[model samples]
Target: MRTTPAGGVVLVGVLAWISGVLQLFAGVLMLVAGDHPVTGWLHLLVGLATFPVCLAIFRARVWARIVLSVVFLFEIAAVVFALTDLRFLATPAVTSAVLAVFGLVLLYTPSANASFRQATIDRRNRAATAR
Candidate 1:
């Protein structure tokens, strides 16, 4: 399971973790401040999902790339929706949107993609050579 660590991925992972914690905290705050639970629950779910993803990214799991890519797209859509309603102008939402964009960009960069691909190729080659 050992894989070469990509610095960009590591940086992205840290940012993801930070954003997740922020979202989780915001969800709690919203829950306490509100009469409704649905919105808070959604934020909580999104936040909870992010912790595992951050770990996966750090480990350079191939699936991490796919999962993060999808999550990025989802968040972008969410941000757009929020912006349309003027709900995304708050400090935390704006910050999370920016961070998510940065993480997505880094993950999709050619260097990051090549590193992950190389890791996969090397692992297969090693396995085949061993056999």
Candidate 2:
């Protein structure tokens, strides 16, 4: 496994922490409050749980990409569903949708791929040169 640079590590850490907090709050709201939340709290909980996956990405954990990708897909579906049902007008669904798409873009872009590869390669090269 390749180690991420300090800056990348910090970025992932902050993202993971913030996302986890948001997920937990959202999940609890859906599960424990309101007459009728748009969705189940379990989804929120799962999202929160998956927050660590984002952090793992910086560490180049293979599973992190797969998991985050799945989360983004789910967010896209949720956005589509909300828009179709006119729920977007009632809540922050549109904003959430936009954020998810942004994440998707980041994950799928060639730049991100190249960056990941470069990071990995650089780490290997540096390690080899050190020896």
Best by TM-score: 1
Q: How many residue pairs clash in each candidate?
A: 0, 0
Name the runs in model 2 displaced over 4 angstroms: 1-20, 34-38, 79-94, 120-131
lDDT of 1 at 97: 70
Q: Could you give candidate 1's per-residue lDDT for residues 1-131 as a string of tens digits? A: 56775888888899888877766765565566644456556557777888898888887778987887776565555444334433433355456678889988899777788778877888798899899
Q: Each prediction's TM-score against the native?
A: 0.80, 0.60
| Model 1 spans with C-alpha error above 4 angstroms | 79-89, 129-131
Candidate 2 lDDT at 64 equals 74
Q: What's the distance in Å from true for residue 64, model 2?
A: 1.2
lDDT of 1: 0.71
Q: What lDDT tens digits, residue by residue, belong to model 2 across residues 42-103?
A: 44754676576776776655457678767756755654544444442424444544555566
Name the lDDT value of residue 18 in candidate 1: 80
State the displacement of the C-alpha of residue 128, model 2, in Å, after optimal TM-score superposition.
9.0
Which prediction has the highest lDDT against the true structure?
A: 1
lDDT, residue 89, model 1: 34
